[model samples]
Target: MNFDLQGRVAVVTGGASGIGLAVSRAAADQDMAVAVLDNNAQAVEAATAELQDRGFKCLGLVVDVTESESVARAVADVEASLGSIDALVACAGISQNTPVVDMSDEEWDRLVAVNQRGVFTVAREIGRRMVARGSGAMVVIGSTDTIGGHINHAAYAATKHAVAGFVQSAAIEWGRAGVRINVVAPGAVDTPLLRTKFDDETAQRVLLYNVPMGRLSRPAEQANASLFLLSDAASYVTGTTLCVDGGLTTGFFYNDQVH
Candidate 1:
């Protein structure tokens, strides 16, 4: 029952918006020093300020997860400002719905650069330090698409699958060193990303297709799941992907509640 992490420090990438922001706040609520890392300088600064105004201890760092130097500098800054890192939640990702036929070389590369390479870069960098310290936890954000196929989601699914694999392998490699790695695969969340992707009617159809709850998930709901995994509550849990999708992917359920 010693899940307390009040005196620890954590890093959350893409912490300026959507689910990332919620996760960062959850870490802060547990009284951890949170570093809000993002590629947008202004967004990071603003998010940091907002969190601080809410009386949470936080720092905003502009970082490009795709760049090693950028990630290195940001991690160092977190260490210098908040002491040894206790946890890391990498939620930075980009989504594009494109069929394989419509996907261009540039688009594919860019998506992989941000969604696939970015997770590896951040996790590898932070995980190395954690391994050296012999204590830490990490959470990588994924999607329902990680488990199944979706129309126009080739690149996104591919990257999410990479994240799933990374979590499993990294957990096994680092478990003996006292480090834990896991993934939180969320369903269709009501975030700016989803808002931009679909209009009112299309959104209902796309988001609620197989969702037993008949509603999109909130970012805070996903954050809560991630917080549990990052905390000592999940000390024995690793290399697992906790689906926060509200039964959206539970195939072949009764539709008796419908109509």
Candidate 2:
């Protein structure tokens, strides 16, 4: 299916690795000029090089999405180097699996800063540009935690909920301005972050047992959903949350025992 994204520009936060990198590669495959933004300089360099070697138009920038000034600079740089941002995929985030009683204040703050505030900062900066131009699309990467509460994931779940809320509110506010904002909540995907939680084969098997698909998701699967939302094919869609979780959040599976 043609996404009709050729020659457009896309900014993908956390584009150096995981689902963000998947999004970057997918965007580039659609012939879009991709700006790969992440906090890790080395990863950014490597990702950019790989894309360039593949003959894709891409730029890599190390950005702290939690800081507005940093985001503003990255946005400006992207526009200066590529063009006006036509789409944004806010994918930079952090996660932890700590029970409410054992979670530290610093861990809570850190997750909020990166996952919640970081998504907001990048979206706000880029969303403003989209609004000013009177046209754009955005997809914020959320999690299944946004819907179902998980064990030892109080903080992570809360931040995801915040992201969903933010997307709905922003979509409503910017709908008239020609800016569409939405969330793509992914379930268990094979990423470094997921490895932290399900490190061993036994843990992974347990996780798969809960998912109806009987397996974990691939990064490309999440990217496919995100790119669809960013494309004109979903022009009429807004203020929605698309769960690409292989039916993991169908509420039929028990999660309490997994953790």
Candidate 3:
């Protein structure tokens, strides 16, 4: 399928590392001028430098996605550098594994701020511009928890559920403006974030036991899904979620034969 993203401009939050970094590289690989945004200023520079070394056009920015002013400024900077925005991949997010009963209100708020509010802030600012131009596409970084329940994932899952709802509603509102909105929900992606879920090796092993693929997804695999959603090839796909999990959300059983 043709991505048709050449010469376009895209903003990828959390693009400094992990899956966001992969998506940023993939967009640049497709000839899109990329704006890599993240709270970590140093990582942003490293990421942009890496892309530049690869001969890809890219800009790195320090952005706090939870703040509307910060997001607006970042978007303005991206447009100033690369021209009008053509796509957005809202991949800035974090994970927490505390049980619901033990989670503090502050922790809950922090999760909501980054996972839910951050997505809304970026999408709203970008969507407004896209609506005015009457053309654009966006892909939010949702998680497998968006559709299924998980133990010790109360706060994280709640925020993702909110993001999922926002995407659906925004899709309805933005469809008429030629702006497509969708989500890519990944399960057990092999990113630094995944390793933070457990304190010991045994817990990680048990978690992966149920995955039918028997391994976490690669960052590029998840990025490919987002790239498709942000491209012309997905013209008819909107207000939907593409799960890039290793079949963890669908259904999985132990092979019993693995030793």
Q: Quick one: best lDDT, which candidate?
A: 2
Over 68-184, each residue of candidate 2 has an lDDT whose tens digit, in order, gives 999999999999999999999999988887889999999999999999999999999998888999999999999988877878888999999999999999999999999999999
TM-score of each: 0.94, 0.96, 0.93
Candidate lDDT (C-alpha), each: 0.87, 0.91, 0.88
Q: Roughly what TM-score does model 1 have, to 2 decimal places?
A: 0.94
Q: What is the per-residue lDDT of model 3 for residues 1-259, given as tens digits with 9 covering 90 to 100? A: 3477899999999999999999999899899999999999999999999999999889999999999999999999899888999999999998776878899999999999999999999999999999999999999999888887677778898989899999999999999999999999998777776666543454346656777777778899988999999888899999999988888777742222222
RMSD of each: 3.3, 1.4, 3.2
lDDT of 1 at 107: 89
Count the clashes in each prediction. 0, 0, 0
lDDT: worst 10-residue window of model 2: 250-259
RMSD of 1: 3.3
Residue pairs in clash, model 1:
none
